[model samples]
Target: MGRAAAAEALTRVRKTLVSVPNLAKVMANSPALVKGWLALPGALSEGVIPAPVRERLAIATAQYNNCEYCLSAHTYIGAHVAEVDAEELERARDAESFDPHIAALLALSDAIARGRGRIDERQPKARRAAGVADAETAEVAGNLAPNLLADTDNEWPVVTPCTHN
Candidate 1:
């Protein structure tokens, strides 16, 4: 795409997200990539998972991937937007939760991120035991995609104190 398209993508991203993240700015260099990045999260938001659980999943996946940017961003979004408690946010980093269903989801997310999309057989069994259906378990990949995309290489010029204003 041309510069105009990239600029348009960046504009759309800012309008959709309400703020332009540094990663979004870098993604603007490839308009298609940035657009696709925006689309995945939008699509996943319509899935079975609750916003708070999804945010926890993102936190767990980010921690697994060692993406400081994603971890910080999701931590803030989890506590603020999703109303996840501070303790829950910290527990999520370890793929844990007081709610068993959410804990299962976070574990599944962490497994997916750690395995790089390949999970062990026992993981699904554990999730199923926790009342997670096959479908909801599958959606973990949907949540993992955007978190993984945020810093695929585990490197994104770490910025502490995620400023989301």
Candidate 2:
């Protein structure tokens, strides 16, 4: 994509996700990565797992990996867009979700973040009992792609404090 088109794409993506999308300012430099970013959310959203579930998993993974930028971004998305509550957000930041279903997904997300996508046996069993399918679990893992990339980027360039405005 040309620079202008890429700029437009970034604007649209940021607008779709956040009003002042701070992370894109750094990430849009890589066009190839943008392509993957474009596809990931849609693919994950298409799965049977709810969008809020994906957000919870993403928040857990971000916090597990100590990515405060992702934690912040996903926290906003989770609360404003996904309608997740303050208690749930705190649970995610603490890596201790009380909701049984979310707790299971958080376990899978934690394992994936720590083990780099290699899940322990017990997590899947818990998810199974929660009626979450393997395919959905895989999608949850995939949904973390943007969070991981954003978190990595956060370590390099200084991302200033952004606002809802």
- Candidate with maximal TM-score: 1
**lDDT (C-alpha, whole model) for all candidates:** 0.79, 0.69
Quote model 2's TM-score: 0.78
Superposed Cα deviation of residue 126, candidate 1 (Å): 1.2
Best by lDDT: 1
After superposition, which runs of candidate 2 have C-alpha atoms over 4 Å from their true positions?
A: 18-20, 149-165
Q: What are the clashing pairs of model 2?
A: none
lDDT of 2 by residue, 62-121 (tens): 666666677777777788889988888767764557787777677776777777768777
What local lDDT does model 2 show for residue 104? Answer: 69
1-165 per-residue lDDT for model 1 (tens digits): 688988899899989988888888778888988888999888878988888898888887767666688887788788879999999988887889999888888888877777877999999789889999877877888887776444433233342432321
State model 1's lDDT: 0.79
